[model samples]
Target: MRIVEVYQSVQGEGLLTGTACVFVRASGCNLRCWFCDTPYASWRPEGVDLTIDEVVAKVEEWDCQHVVLTGGEPMLFSELIPLTQQLANRERHITIETAGTLYLPVACDLMSISPKLSSSAPALASNPHWHRRHQRERCRMDVIQRLVREYVYQLKFVVDRPADCQEIEEYLAALEDIDRERILLMPQGTHPDELADRTGWLAPYCQIKGYRFCPRKQFEWYGTVRGS
Candidate 1:
């Protein structure tokens, strides 16, 4: 796998936030969201190359039950199965953070699929190459359907406006196979307050719609400081 950075940190988001965890951030993403906070992992080269055993050893050193395989899009690298296998052997719980752009056929304890809506406006302005690339290559929503169904698989989206909610409903409508209760909505914000500002409104929004609200737990506790 092409690894960007690996470190021991608390789970920063989703259901596992604040849990002691080992993070494996792989290099090279297939998308370019304009507001992406981890551009170091995406647009720039900020990674070191390491063998699978070396990476696994690092996780063992952390000695935690939670191991999060994240990325630039860890799915970009296929050797994740080997690492997951090692973690499984050690009985560590493993979670995969993916953009739902690519399909994964490996085993995982949790599949957190965050599908990027068109309103994400990835490459909306600066990415001269992204617009063409986005159109040329098909973006598949089918991956969300095929995740190891043993886990209901959580769904999240970064939203900045009310229109984004409508988009989520439309997307979910297309995938009638997915249970609506599995989806949670959170507003987009590089910082948590941007998330909190609309929290009052969003909670009711989700309540009225019967969806769940997800706060960016990392930001709620630690503000802008990274890697809690």
Candidate 2:
């Protein structure tokens, strides 16, 4: 597996926010989000490829009980099957953070699926190639449905505007057996100031809609720097 950074930190978003955890950020992505905070792991990936044993060793170095298999898009790697099994054997609570476009059968305590919205696409003026590719690859309802049914899951959406909220509703309606309470709406931003600005209205919107409102607690507590 190509590993980006393995570090101990609090779960920053979705249902597990504030939980102390070891984050294993896999370094690659299938879609490019314009607001990606970990661009090093996505838009331009960087990391050393490690065997499952090496990656497991690094994770064991942390004293945390919860482990997040996050990405660029962790589900992209076939190595995750063995990696996740190894982690589960060690009895670590596992959370897999994925774009929800791909599905892999693996052990996961929480499948944190953040399906990219149309707003994630970069403008044509910015990067036409990624803009097109991102739009084409972002949403896969079939894969999402399977993921939700097969695992304990949460559907987390990054909300940049009010229109994005409507898009999420339409997506949920299309998905079968989706629990609305498992849906989390998080403000889109990498910095505290930007998060605050979006959270002002986004949080209330979530409240009114009865969706769980997620905050970027890591950015709030540790700022936007890497290894948070």
Candidate 3:
């Protein structure tokens, strides 16, 4: 598999925010979001190749119980099956961060599914290839539905504006048995100041909708640097 960087960092988003964990960020993505923070992993893939055993060995060095298999869509790799199994064998709590556009029968303690909304679509002028490809592959409702039903999950949506809230609501309404509490609405920003600016309205929106408001605590604690 194409391995980006493996490191120890506090879980920055979702229900386990602030929890110490090891992150295995896989390079390459099926869809490109306009605001992807880890462009090295997606916009222009970068990383060395590592076998499943080597990846597992790296995670073991952290001395942490929690592991996050994130991406540029980590689900894109087949090595995930063995990777998750190896972590489970060690009793490490596994969290798979995915775009929820694809699925693999990998084991996970928490399936962190971040479904892209219309707001995530890039403009036609901004690299037409990715713009078209991102929109085309962004949402796979069948995949999202199956993931939520099969795994201990959380549905995280990146909200940039109040209008995006309606789209989220509509999405949830269309899905069956989606737990309201499991829904996380995170402000779309990278920098601390940028996050703060959007949190003003987004936090309130989450409150009113009975959804959890997820802050990018990593941005506040570690700034917008690589490896958390």
Weakest ten-residue segment in model 1 by summed lDDT: 131-140
Q: Please, what is the TM-score per model?
A: 0.90, 0.97, 0.98
What range of 10 consecutive residues in model 3 has the weakest lDDT sum?
A: 121-130
Maximum-lDDT candidate: 2
> Model 3: residues >4 Å from true position, as ranges?
none
Superposition error at 114 for model 3 (Å):
0.3
Decoy 2 TM-score against native:
0.97
Cα lDDT over the full model 2: 0.92
Residue 217, model 1: Cα distance from true site in angstroms: 1.4
Name the lDDT value of residue 66 in candidate 2. Answer: 97
Order of models, best TM-score first: 3, 2, 1
| Candidate lDDT (C-alpha), each | 0.75, 0.92, 0.91
Instruction: State the lDDT of candidate 2 residue by residue for 72-110, as single tens digits.
Output: 999999999999999999999999999899988899999
What would the per-residue lDDT of candidate 1 be over residues 66-85, giving only the tens digit for each residue? Answer: 88898878887778777788
- Which pairs in model 1 have colliding backbones? none
Candidate 2 — which residues are off by over 4 angstroms?
none
lDDT (Cα) of model 3? 0.91
